[model samples]
Target chain A: MIAKQTNQKAWFMVLPVFLVVAFSAVIPLMTVVNYSVQDTFGNNVFTWVGMDWFKDLIHSERFHAAFLKQLMFSGIILLIEVPLGIMIALAMPKKGWGVPVCLISMALPLLIPWNVVGTIWQIFGRVDIGLLGHSLASLGFDYNYTQDPIAAWITLIIMDVWHWTSLVVLLCYAGLCSIPEAYYQAAKIDGASRWSVFRYIQLPKMQRVLLIAILLRFMDSFMIYTEPFVITGGGPGNSTTFMSIDLVKLAIGQFDLGPAAAMSLVYFLVILLLCWVFYTVMSNIGEESSNGGK
Target chain B: MNFNWMAWTAPTASFFGIIFCLLVIMTIWELKCPGGGPRIGILRFETTRGDRLFVSLLGSAFIHIFWLALFPGLSLYWALVFSCIYALAVFRWV
Candidate 1:
């Protein structure tokens, strides 16, 4: 009903996407689901264990701890990046050569791979070798991620902020750029302060992009793996071990397929549910905007 | 959401077992009407080979490999490097 009219040409447009998702997303998901259900020992002997793994995973403290850590991490990152990105976006020059420079510099961090981001920070936070750690230590701060749980958490959070704030900045910048000159021009004639203009015009305009930025960052951060793993190895203690790390430990570290699969499904569902809530909120704003336009 | 354990297990097992069924159904849909796919990054190139995708990945891999060799017991870095190369290639070729 949603797509009642046939657009045969659009199928061509959609074909490549379907193939890629099928190969990557769908297939892997199936494998994970498969692993979740059945019991296996060594080479391919999979006995039907049913929902045993799921039950164990759901009740486990490890899973709960990881889930809580994930929630906290997402909440903290979104709080930091969204507001910081908005401020940075607002401060950015709108016209002339400054635009390109700001845009390019903002985009540079985003181009770096997630693991490399971890590596960069790993090297970066070394007291003897790296800049930040050395500077902090010079100022008499005890900075050692290898032995300190607090330090590892801080390092991972900083690494994530460094890598992903660019995304929020770019999205907010796009939203800012989309505001017609007339709005600002009229606001100017009415003698609006910078705060008033930003509050009335820029902030509302950015609602959609901000929502997208939040949802994307939430889901990615919730499902984060490589960066923290590379940087701290979920280390010092299990303090920073998020859900994905727990799942990986179950599946690969302990070779416990059943529990891991179960946990992965639950993890997947949590992400999906959060995404739906975020989606509903975003769409409500979009609907309100369009209705106002009408 | 009632966990009979038995009922939950059956559907869960069959859910995985019927994998080829869904794949076939999706393949049919693909045959009839292909729609969204993963986005590919299109880099500008001066040459026809346009092996920039491979080149960029190998360059990244080289950096990690170099780091791994220099730092004893840091070979786990290569796993991330390989995953990156795989993701990029998937965006390119798959």
Candidate 2:
């Protein structure tokens, strides 16, 4: 299937995509970079500020707490969603009309708008009229998301799980479906148990898609803002104020553009670094598993 | 018969209810024409009907989220317009 000569003209096909990305992503990122190194006041007055904002942000207790909270939230969601999604995908019906039914149902939560998801939980957690809050109260539990920090955190976590586990499920299901039928048939001929089949065949095959799912979930959860914003509005205290929320509060709420811009660059870098680590580690594990199987 | 309709009228309920309806419609459509055959699209990968559905739904969700985030005070109808166009393109090409 190798072509005799390499054709360079195919690169032209990708030009439009590159242009769109540059305009939509690169330009605005440059603007943020510009703001991160400069101070501005009324009448568009600007002053060079160097790395002062970044230095301050590094030392700020508020930034540290928010960063830690963001880490905890992302860690918790990944822990819950990845395993839960795999279980759900494993339990799904493999044949007949049930496959589409299951996929559609699972995908439903993911299609809803994020702010709408936030707003939904906001109302759904009202102690007076919301279903979850009311049911919890009737069951003799003290549940007030607006007043209690623990309850607010729990609500946020639950809301995130409900909204996002479907994504992981869908990705895992796709991975499962891509596995060849001959693998299962070979396992059957070898009298392999279900667990062994999954481990030796399905799990290895799913590693790539699983990595993708983890990367996406990590990035999205780390940058989560609108959902929490609409739900607890950063909570009874700053309990749920993740880095993104804190940046928004600094930029818009307090009009500290320079610091906010610097914080955002740091946030973006953190996500990029974590994703690289995840990709490298997961790919190494994938190689090791494949080598061991061989 | 004194059930509180207000309880069922919440936006969350409506959003979920709409999703359920979409699922039902998709199920019925699948029943009418069972579709698992793979076709190559713009992505140049073999994909089936379910894959397209997942991509379109996921893409539209991001489009709506980005739309709302970028233009806070604007009506979501504009996002809906973009999402619809995106769905059409996905179905037609990918």
Candidate 3:
């Protein structure tokens, strides 16, 4: 047996990282907290307002609408992306020269910068000069994302699906690839049906990655800003105004610092709570299943 | 030294101060008694002391926010009391 040496120098090693995180995250967060509870005029003059901002935000009809719309967008995105990703992953080549080609193509969308993605989609959805818009117009389908709420939403959703479904596909592919050949061999020897093999073997194997995929997708879609912002600019009306877009409008456009700060805290807290719940439940399920296996 | 940009307010400062103090206390406690093992509670999920603390703090934030929203004219002291009780219950069982 070996005794581990305790070195106080480890604290010194950790100091740089601690300082970096404190400066980047903690300071900004403290500032946000300060702003949330205080009303401010332009010259950095501030007055304490206590919980007024939070109260107003919670009761605001505008806030409620944006939140509900955000929820629906994320819900629709997940409902589309996850299953589509899994199906794509299943259909992809397992080996040989085709694997690299498929992988590269899948990775391309993810590599594009977020703002660039937004710009691309913006231009891509324009009725005057865009392929998609022109094609739809030529086909006699009434589709103008600039004017129509449903068209705006469908374009945004489809753009997100195109951009991010690859992530889910890649994660699921890794999960699928990890399944040992012996499991398939065993299933084959037993004359197990394809559906049964997938249901019992593949699904369970993908659970961990699926948890990661869902959490990432949920958080990303929940806080989505760039693509939708560029494409629709929160609308012909306020129809596409997701929470983040509305927050930006309040904070930047209206310069309502107190309310915006309060809204930011609430938004952050919602994400934190939901992520915590998702992580705990999924990990518990994993633990129970592993225990049963043992 | 030059933290004027942060626009520090008393309430927010104290909030961070208390959180910092809680973290330090938890660290000391962990040093004194190692291994805060996961325990399944009423929630039917495994959580350690740190997890319980996180959950309590998060729950307290919601309670305070909700209290402000629902009881606009009321003092926040009652909300603090409720949060304290919530924390105690969480530490005891969850």
Tens-digit per-residue lDDT, B20-43, candidate 1:
574575567656665433233343
Local lDDT at A52 for model 2: 66
Residue B9 accuracy (lDDT) in model 3: 78
- Fnat of candidate 3, please? 0.79
- TM-scores of chain A across the candidates, in order, are 0.93, 0.95, 0.96
Candidate 2 C-alpha lDDT tens digits along B1-94? 6423112223434655676687787788787887755687886555667766766666665575456456656776898899889988887887
Candidate 3's displacement at residue A265, Å, is: 0.4
TM-scores for the candidates: 0.74, 0.73, 0.97
Candidate achieving the largest DockQ: 3
Clashes of 2: 0
**TM-score, prediction 3:** 0.97
Clashes by residue pair, model 1? A14-B35, A17-B36, A17-B37, A18-B36
Q: Look at candidate 2 and tell me the lDDT of residue A261.
A: 83
Q: For residue B67, what is the lDDT in candidate 1? A: 47
Off by over 4 Å in 2: A1-4, A291-294, B1-94
Better of 1 and 2 by TM-score: 1
